[model samples]
Target: MTGATTSVELRAHNRVRLLRAVHDCGAGRTRSQLTRDLGLARGTASVLVAGLAEDELLHEEPAAGRARGRPTQIPGPHPRGPVALAVDVREDAWELAECELGGRTTVLEVGPHDGTPEGALAPLGEAVAAHRRRLGHRVAGVGVALAGPVRPGGLVDIGHLGWRSVDVPLLLGLGPGTPIAVGNDTAFAALAEARRGRLRGVRVGLHLHVDFDVGGVLVVDGRPLQGAGGMGAEFGHMPLGGGDRPCACGAVGCWGMDVGANALLRHVGLAYGGGRGRAQAEHVLATSEEAVAAGARALGRGVAALVNAHDPEVVTLSGLGAELRERAGEALVAACEPGLMSIRRDRPPLIESSALGWRGALLGAMESVFDAFLTIEGLELWRRNRGDGGPDTPERQNVTNSTFAEDNSI
Candidate 1:
């Protein structure tokens, strides 16, 4: 019995590795390539692929434009396989997207909201339910990226929206059964950066998204460092600078007061609010060069402070951060210089803009759900869901209520 259990565990582990390899390779890989990547024999790779295909988790299709020798088949995600619903809640808008196993995402819907919890989530929830009904059990999970600090159990602290301790799961109205994962919008963006964006493969990286405010995460070896209650990288709230300007979070001298869209709008004497400030900030960026320079300088200083504290290998900026650096030019670099320590002055962390751009958070949300449903236990559940006569093991029975499945709901 023990030997049998060991064999099962090893098979499960190898299967997971195989699926992950296929997932990481965006366009898909031939069986021979997967065999080499996973260090498995050709026969073993064939067995794994056959099992996944039988369960409708993956499939093998003829490689496109294959030249001559032995027609190669690329293993890819099954067309009708389980998918993840990704919801991105911005300052003034909400977006929903669907991501399949291979990281291919299709935007389903996008609309503006009034910044109120119910106002935003009610319509969003209805949309989610509609998709859930249409897709049925093929909808494996849902991931929400909110523009705020997300506590465990889907509670959120959206300071700019004047919302505190909002119960996201309750507001989302998905009730029970449907797996949901909620996280800080910027943290999710950083996750996407770490996995599929500019921060990929870096030992240490910093990812900041400058929207209505500056928010970020410090990723080490592809994992974002989540502080207690998963609120570690609220860099915008830090008092790196801003000179006594009261912030929407009720904090004075927050770095956010000097950077991001809200700060730009305020500096340019344009109206700024959680529900309706983004357009004005865009206008400022397009017209008010002075405000752009000021915000960029502050952003650079804040980046310097974070680098001094964390010493990341690279810094990736998304949203307006890239534009700020481009427009501010040398002034931003100059602002960052004074804050750097002398030893680090020679070669500070390289700051670059995220290539994923606006899609970061949405992609990250997809990743979060994929992380949950792509596990060994998750595969067992999937097999069982297909009524494939999978064993009724304790792991299979209990996997549905795992921490990532139940506790991360939104």
Candidate 2:
């Protein structure tokens, strides 16, 4: 009901900011560095860090080889600090990783499926439960990237998996107490590109994580332009100007139907399924010269169409699409030039492969999980983990019904 920014809340915000400033600094940050970087006074910065250390969220490590000046300790993630769980669920597999405040990630497991995404839920739940038991309350929050369209009220519709209106939190056995952040896989990949990879400095970048099909997000600033119900940009669903083939998404002529691994597989007459996608694409690229050229040409046409519609500063691709962009090379560029407007033909957006490679979705998911904890209520969560048993604000972010819109300063 309250729409006001409070004083206590302001302090909590600053506390989280200071913690993040150090966390984002990779290895760690010195006392003086934290002070200067966070714009906090020396004593104030020390006090804030002391508070975090007391809560076991951060710790001070000695400057081992420093020969001169005051030997200052750099702030680092406590061995038993709060860790965010990052999950990237594919059509037939899922990867779970633990990310620390200091940006180090440990892949806990990658479980495969039996062509049943619905059945995958049980194992996913068990894995999360196991991780929670191992990490205790330090298992802060979870960021999940789903290979499907997540509808309003957290309902997911994965056409490939034949899953509709799936409640992610309930299926994962994540009770109401656990804060869960969910996003489309490709959108989160674009987020990864923007924050940690090729789109790092590009303002109007478009990240297309081409796998089974081309799905991506258009980044305006640093945030992906989310659609209604958080379905993300859903670029793949756009009608192809070429194909009449039926899409797995229950549509005909979808760009997704004609311009991904499936398309590549079909172009060379290969059996279709999520399992054999990578192997099939690799085989065609490695063995068949004609198939490789044909696939790349198709990719070129699709990329050109998308670029003509959305003038992104850069287009970063992952998976087989990236390989196509590479192999296609000048043929792809020349194919796209005619599609571009006269002015844009001279300076088309750069098409490049993902710098983060396979880890992009995982890293982006972890970032979301971490951001869920960088809020007013999150202050109390950290305090509670440190055994500071006290009544606090509601265990929810200050903003309601929306993610990525409020306090994205991180």
Candidate 3:
């Protein structure tokens, strides 16, 4: 009985590790590569692959290149397998996308939305429901990225949009049983960078997404350091920029007042409200050198303050932050150098633009959903539903039911 329970647990653990490895690879791997990477015997790996294939979670194809030996097969996400749904709810727009294993994402829909939370959520819920109906059980879970701080229990706080304590899951109308993970937009974007974008191999990294305002995450060892309540990185709220203007987040003299689209628009004397005036803001950055200089100076100084504190290996920028870096150039550097600590002035962290672009939040959301769905319990349920008794045969049922001390490890 003990041996049987151990075997079941080990099998589940190995399966999870295999899936996670494939997902991390981004391009999938051949059977030989998977076996070698996982350190599993050839027969054991074959059995595991066959089980996953039978459950419709994985499929194999001929290796891309012509090989010398037997035509080895490469495993990948099953064509009709489960997909994680993701939604990036921006300040004035939203995008819905789906992702399979190996980080492949397909944008399903994109549209603008009203400022009101109810108006924005209803259409999003409807769109998700429509996709659920079409895909049935293939929809593994849902992930939502919002332009705000997300607290526990999915409470969202979008300061600029004037929204507070928004119950994202309830409003999405996906029901209690539906697995929904809601998070901060910038945090998700940072996660995307840490996983598949610019921050992939960095030991410690900082990611900033400058939109109407600034927000970001601090990543250490490829994972975002989500604070005690999961609302840690609100860097824009820090008073790094010397200003007296009130911020939407009920704070005065926030660093955000000096940077982002709002700062650019304000510098250029354009009326901005509810995430509007992005076009005008861009035009201002392009046309008004003074506005660009001011915004860039503010952005660089604030980033330098953060650098002096966090000491990250690199800093990656996305959205309007990238534009600021490009437009500011030497002026931005001058502002940053003055603000940096004297000891660190010689060699500062590398600051660069992220290549992920708008897809960062969406990809991060999908990755979050996949993380939730690929758990041990979730995989066990999937196996049971598929009725493919790969390891747990009838004779092993009683033994498998017994609890073990290490059951929680996986």
> Mind giving the per-residue lDDT tens digits that candidate 1 earns over 170-204?
88885544478898888888888888988999999
TM-score of 2: 0.87
Error of 3 at 201 (Å): 2.5
TM-score of each: 0.93, 0.87, 0.90
Which candidate tops lDDT?
A: 1
Consecutive 10-residue window with the lowest summed lDDT within model 3: 401-410
The C-alpha local distance difference test score for the whole of candidate 1 amounts to 0.82
| Candidate 3 Cα deviation (angstroms), residue 97 | 0.2
lDDT of 3 by residue, 1-410 (tens): 22336878888888877788888887468889989998999999999999888888888889878768789888889887778888999888889998998889988998788877888898999899888667655666788999888877677888888899998877887554456778888888988898899999999999989999888779999888778778887899999898999988999999988888998888767888688887888789789889888987888898899999999889999988888888776787889889999987988988889889878889889888777667787676555544333212442232222311111000
- The lDDT-based order of candidates, best leading, equals 1, 3, 2
Best by TM-score: 1
Task: List CA RMSD, all candidates.
Answer: 3.6, 4.4, 5.7
The predicted structure with the larger TM-score, 1 or 2, is 1
Residues 265-328, candidate 2: write the lDDT tens digits. 7778888755446667677777766666666666666777777778888988886677777777
Model 2 scores worst on lDDT over the 10 consecutive residues at 401-410
What ordering of candidates by TM-score runs from best to worst? Answer: 1, 3, 2
